[model samples]
Target: MTSIEETAPGRDHFTDFDLDSPEFTEDYEQVLGDLVAKCPVAHSKVAGGYYVVSRYDDVRQCAQDWETFSSEGGFEPGRGGEGGAKLYPVELDPPYQTRWRNALGPYFSPRAIRSREANIREQVNYLIDGFIEKGRVDFVEEFAAHLPGRVFFGSFLGVPFSELPPIQKATDDAMRGPMEGRGEAWVAVATFLDGYLRARQEEPPRDDFIDVILAGVEDHDGNPCSWDHKLYVLTDLLAGGIGTTTYLLAGIAHHLATHPEDRAALAEDRSLWSGAIEEFIRYYASIVALGRTATRPTEVAGQSIAEGDFLMLSFAAACRDPKYFENPHEIDIRRKIAVNPAFSFGPHRCIGSHIARLEATISLEEILRRLPDLALAEGGEPVYSNSTIARNMDSLVVTFTPGEREGRTE
Candidate 1:
């Protein structure tokens, strides 16, 4: 699809770009390519207007200089903290944000995440078993959407598996459901988190990730964190944990279904999986952009940014910058990458990145070994939904040769 710039002469991308608009979302690769090549720093009038930074060097510099471009302003462009709860650490600047990251960092370290590999594999197989006998399934609904929540509840947060449905539904609705009903959906999510945290406080320590939140960190003013502040931290973890990885999972499944050669290559060689996952992250990045506020006057890619002005660093766009990548659009699993901005950069880089990679690695390994003949359903096509902050494949139907369930070996 041609960019909106070509299709509609009046809507110049430099001044009238809307990340969430159908024009941009439907043909984002071409549109983002245009932005990177022509206007590295483009302005969007949508959501009260903000500047977008699209080049690889520009995004890295802005992300590294937190003092100049503060995150305390929030990540979403027009709507900051859409659900009414502030996501801490992410929405905070350094020193203060530093304290929180320092406290929570150990839990997401490679060794810590590595320990959960067994349970993660079990969860992956458990979901696959549900549809293995049927010869067909909606990968998003039946598989991708459920794995994160299961791992979150069963491993990270230590919630009961039975509680997954209501919380997961509330999160999905709050994130991508109808605009009118989002407020109520967010309320459900917040209410659940509040109750869960309060209950955890009264119980004996479990020495788990939630325990770290309950222990609390010093606030920006050097005082002990407030009760509500603690709630904000918990909210961030839950929201991040439950939803973000689904996009990567669904995208990979869809890619495998559509490209037989890529699937055949991956199925034949297991060693290719690591580089493949990183390439998938770079090529099919799910995070579109994240917002940062300029603290004072600064210049990025020759574009002047004033104090209090909003700037969106496009991680997806950075990954596609042609200067750094040869064929930025095509999926090359063996491609070498020095720096991948898929998880953003600097201190606010996704703490869950290790877990996300592990999940994708195990997921691809099992799906290929078990369902060798996976292909798109006869007439099924992927439907997508986009927001200012993230984009996801909503549904992907696939047909595979029916196989027997490898029931739990416990």
Candidate 2:
């Protein structure tokens, strides 16, 4: 295995563009477009020793071929070691990874998620009720950010609303990348889940997700998945599901507020919900990139990459690549859409994709119904997250007409 230092001589890739820069976040589409056009497989010295794959075909292939590009180590540079362990099945390769994934798959299936719809809708309405009367609210914190964490935890673990705050805090910290005191936060969350899992194991089964995972039997590397493994998997699910969905929700709200015509068109026909969500995902590409390590020395698109070299597959760039979709830069809800790498492609595709769609679709439909004339607050600018793994807005303020019914009493 090539060390991080020896992988590239003399420089790091991705120095010119600051992944966290406000300018990049503001003009992300334009910047990525230029890069794809100029150098689809560009190498940057600033990003340590990694190469960026921006074209649609390249990214799709990188995601599909687990043999050539392994996900075992952390996808991004410097994250593969200890930091990557928290990702669970996502950070593991096939065969071994498949066991854990298959074990948890039934819990997030379409039918299972549908069973929770009434509860989800009630929760959404509750959150919206708290803010709808105000006419103006920060959609991220007051609404979007709160919904997913609560719903996922409530439905999966059968936890009470009181536990959401600390869970949300830990998940948010994890999404922001490694931080001081995060170890303690992870421990606290893990400890709580361990107790919960042990309790569930002893009791008669409930229909919730925790019951499903615990009741099912699976072996990882000759050993049964202990409570620790279950806790880690839950942590990964909470972090991955909540943060990305929140970002996409904020993105949709931001776009709709600015482009009333699109919102109006959708309002006229609620059947367009599915397509509208797809268009939103393609337009925003919230989770910017997926990380991979070259399992063996591989040559892609005429560029030679050595074994163990870090690679960043730019999903944001690929989704908008004109090679795949015409007028890729423009957002058109009417466009005939197909499978997008937005939820990723191949084996490691998002397990919670169905749930995410249900959440986003329900949230959008309800928001439009309650406040049809929503618009961004005057001079409001979105605050975005900085991590390379996930792209998200921190906050979005909006103004809309009040609903007849109040949402949450608190």
Candidate 3:
């Protein structure tokens, strides 16, 4: 995409629009609305040749045709053309993908997630209690950034607390795209996983996710998936499970802070939270966009797409399509329950969607219960990390009247 410091000629063309442009973070709805209205299948020059599908129907069509729009065309920052760290099932297709899904999806299934609620509640409450008395807190670092990973990665996946920090850093750094020493950082992570597996190999089988995975989660061939494959699975699980929730929670918190009317309604009517959470997820989709490569000559939204060409599905944009959503810009908690693209679509729809919903629901209920008076913490401002793939707030400072905890037992 083209950019100019001053208003230069030909800036009105869709080619001048860029997902990575800083303006997108500020007003994507406005920008993407224009794209959908004018160029639903607009071409972008950034990150090699790509066509961005902005309309809901078009994006949905691409997602449905995974055969034509393969997810195997990776999105890693470096490693030659491939996206960083293989994402297992998300990076696989069909029967093989089904194997990866079976091995992992059950863990986050709604029934399985119920087993985690007590701990999730305890963990979330404990984190809030840490700063509840202080009346102010950095929600991102102190909570959002730490909680989901701690639950899914640290607690569920059985990574020792002592070893989580470095690996978490490595995964994050590597995802922020190609940078100096990303390979080294990735290697460090792989080395840690290797050692972790080796240590597990010596011990008796345990019930932990790691132990079960190590004991032998079979591939499509009915043989155990290789350690390398396992490493990517672990990496994908950790990476996918953490920041997505972090950003979503952060976005919700931001919404509550900025839109106090909606916040008040949610607070007053607890039953509204479940649907409201979904609405919030739609309104402020943090996993903004994902890519698929055309496997062969394909057509979408009347635009001819060549094989091997990249097509970016703008989920945030799709969620706001006026065709599907009335008063699209306005946040309505009671919007009729139809398909939402916040978790994506088709076979690759978010595996942890149920877990994420439960977590967000519980979190919403608890935070509102405890901090009924919570608001923007003094003069604090929210910060965000904007990228084409995802744009999440970096931090959100919020305040509430110092309150007592429920002191529930574990």
Candidate 4:
């Protein structure tokens, strides 16, 4: 088996393209269409020696067949190489990965999530009311971004809402890649969570997720999870639950604001919210791609890939693949969906996906019901975060018609 490090002497097809370019985000459809048509499995010299899989089936297969394409290295190539330590279940391959999954699964179950819906809704409406009086506000900061962070911090840990902003900012900075002065941001989150966990450790278990995980026994690992493991898991939960949900909500808002017809259709009939949300996931696909390393030499789509090769599975490209979706570029709420790997596939699929959907659905429904006349700020596009793992707009300024604020119940 040829090692991935052994560079093959071949013309790299995607050398002309730059993934970090803003044009790539703005004109992703055209770019993805071109990639799918010309080279579905193209070699990239710029991506530090990794083959890019742009087609839907190829990417799906990479995610499904965990044995062939292992995540032991980590998800993102850059991050995977950095820490030297793999973070819990996301970095572990099955049957070992199964243990981590099972341990965290019960807490995020549909029934467990439903139990927190009342509290989640309460926080959502509270944030909505805080900015509703302005009539025009940055939806991302004021609403979309704020909801998940507060809910995760406050509801999940029973923390005060006042403490959420600093934590949210720290997590956001950490995920958006290493920035100047951002090194301490992650440490800040760790420090805060450590203190919070220690304080809660002596108390009786409650309905919150922290309590569940702290008290719950490990099903596979045999020994109880150490406080360090619990902290890592909680950090993962906070980052995944808040960051991705914020991006999805922002994406939904962007799509609705830009596409008037779709917005009108959704506004008129709230029943279409489910389909619209699905379409949003397909269209924006909060994550652009997920990374994996080849456990051994493998052949995929007639291309010979070497062992220890880093693979970039293009989630954005896959969702827009014409082979699977008709009019792949079009955002159609009415499209009948079979299955899309937007939430991913197989054992490593998103654990918090159900909760993400619920949060997005509830947020969208409430926004539409209360502010039907919502419109993007004149002559402005939302500011998006430059991130590999999560696709998100930073700030979305929206103007809404004047109206009486609705009262929220817990």
Candidate 1 vs candidate 3, lDDT winner: 1
lDDT of 4 by residue, 201-257 (tens): 888767566775576455346777566667766777777777678878888877777
Steric collisions counted per model: 0, 11, 4, 0
Q: After superposition, how far is residue 77 of candidate 3 from its true place, in Å?
A: 7.3
How would you encode candidate 1's per-residue C-alpha lDDT over 105-219 as one tens digit per residue?
9988989999999989988998898899999999988999888877876677666656677887887788767889999999998898899888988999977778888888888
Which of candidates 2 and 4 is the stronger one according to TM-score?
2
lDDT of all the models against the reference? 0.84, 0.76, 0.73, 0.74
lDDT of 2: 0.76
The model with the greatest lDDT is: 1
Per-prediction TM-score, please? 0.94, 0.89, 0.87, 0.88
Least accurate 10 contiguous residues by lDDT in model 1? 1-10
Candidate 4 off by > 4 Å: 1-13, 16-18, 81-86, 176-178, 215-226, 405-410
Candidate 3 backbone overlaps, count: 4
Each prediction's RMSD over C-alphas, in Å, is 2.6, 4.9, 3.9, 4.9
Candidate 2 differs from the real structure by a C-alpha RMSD in angstroms, to one decimal, of: 4.9
Error (Å) of candidate 2 at residue 235 is 1.4
**Model 1 Cα shift for residue 337 (angstroms):** 1.8
Q: Which candidate is the best by TM-score?
A: 1
